[model samples]
Target: MEIFELDKEQWKDFKLHFKWSSDKYYKVDIRKTQTGLMVELKLQTTDKPIVKDYEEPLWQQWMDEESDDEAQIFGVKIDSEIVGWMTVGMESWNNRLRVYELLVLEGYRRRGIGKLLLDKAKQIARQKNCRAIILETQTNNVNAIEFYKKQGFEFDGLDITAYHNDDVERNEVRIEMVCRNF
Candidate 1:
């Protein structure tokens, strides 16, 4: 496996297919008071896994708004084919590295490709003097959550209404995860 920086043109041809079927999801419990808010998160798996294939309309819109020119994208090439990819950019305000995307092809899953990409992202973050590597994911993506946790990421926060008016109801609540460099 070879990991290297890829240009935007190369990224344009790269296709990402995210498919997940989980019998479980992270259930969030929120407590709010006059002072602040407290949240408790836990995973609940059922007898049957609920399967959902994420459509990327919202993500596409977000990508449209965000500048890709400033992003540093790395691709994992296996036998000259891109099997995994990750993108990281500096968040100037927070002095952190925001992971825009980290994906491996379905056939490449659970083969350490994602870890390689994550490791590369960390290396880049250190080189850029960032404090942490941050990314947002949906609560329904239990597999991804486990992967993030295995990669040393912890739940930072969550936005109950990040994508739409009924985000939590729709089970698409956005949860932020962070892997601190310092």
Candidate 2:
């Protein structure tokens, strides 16, 4: 497999679509405290597997056109077919590198493609003098969370309302994972 950087035009033409299933998810609970608030995330096993299918473009509609944030996209191709990709960008204000997206096709998973993409992200972070590498994933994405954890990332924060007002109840809370050492 060959991993190469994708130009803007190539990125525009690339479409990332994948499906993932999980039998466990994190249950989020927030409560008001005397001084502040207490937030708890508990791992829970679901009665049935939860599956999510997504299709998205490299450039999101919410991205600012005039902003200095420019994403660097990389892809892994096998036999001239794209099987995995990652998108990373520098967050100047936070002095950190943000992984916008990381996806590996279903049949191509478990072959270290994701790790290669992540290693490339780490390389970029080192070159940019980034303080850390951060990325977001849903609470229901247990596999992804485990993968990130194995890659030296820890839970940094979470957004209970990222997807909807009842994201926590829906088992889709947004979790922010960070790798500070690399």
Candidate 3:
């Protein structure tokens, strides 16, 4: 397997292995999505809330994160097909970077692919002068939570009622983790 940069143009067919894992472990509604589920960060957030609001433009805020220095997008390719990916980016004014998306394809799990991607992100985070790293996943995703813990991350906070009518899978909870450069 190899890792390379990825752009939104390549996102059309490169969705993570979420559905397959969801089917076996959890379940998918196949109708609604929680794409609009923000981190419920705080009363004053700088992201511009491109996901839920309808003021300026729809995907403008999404694209805002794609800037070169602030973020790095990588696609894991194997056998001429894209199977996994990891995106690392920094949160402005926080001195902490994060692994935005870390995923491996369905039949590609348990083969160390996810670990490789995660390690790569950590390496990059340290190189970028990040005092720490942060990432989030659903509470029900026990596998991911465990994986993050094994990688030296610790529980930082929780966002209750993160998912409701916006997603068919209601009552979903979001948990946050932080890893110091120590």
Candidate 4:
């Protein structure tokens, strides 16, 4: 039930979920034991490093995302295990403090881990005097859409083809989450 700042030492448990494309989805694993959660992936091959193509600089940047305290990232750990992660940052459109990427591991999902992460993020936002908590999710992630809705997030409307490329589509719908300070 405690949230800590993400560190490289926890990499053995955290991996990025990558969407190569709608039909060809794959999670690019970070196999190194140095920093950040090097999430164990079932799909990874034994002999090769986890990230083969988009490695190095991107890996460093991914690690950097864990701590932008002006915009912070927090990891939920129980019994020395990282169960979830969430972030609070500036929304690009309004320049308002927002909580964006939120994720709880697959097996850890539905155990209220996500709520714990969000609750911590909300406290952080209030401390920072943030306007609200905002997030963007793709239509394909129906479960997340529903979860956010139940958490009091309301549709601000949809963005047309917000993100799309030849290899992938970023047509994510944006939802706004307001955090009212008590």
lDDT of 3 by residue, 41-120 (tens): 22122222212211121122343364346456677788898777776777756777777777776678777787778777
Give the clashing residue pairs of candidate 1, or none.
23-49
Q: Write the per-residue lDDT of candidate 4 for residues 1-182, one digit (tens) a residue.
A: 67887644444344555321232112223356766556321222224222211211112334335434444557888788877776556543453556555777667788888888777766765675666666665444446666777776655534433554321232233334454441
What's each prediction's TM-score? 0.85, 0.93, 0.66, 0.58
Each model's RMSD to truth, in Å?
2.9, 1.7, 11.4, 13.7
List model 1 lDDT by residue over 80-123, tens digit each. Answer: 79888777777766777888888888888999999998898788
Clashing pairs in 3: none
The best candidate by TM-score is: 2
What TM-score does candidate 3 reach?
0.66
lDDT of each: 0.78, 0.87, 0.61, 0.53
Least lDDT summed over 10 consecutive residues: which range in candidate 1? Answer: 55-64
Candidate 3 error regions (>4 Å): 12-14, 20-63, 66-68, 165-171
Off by over 4 Å in 4: 7-14, 18-69, 91-95, 165-182
Q: Per-residue error at 104 for model 2, in Å? A: 0.3
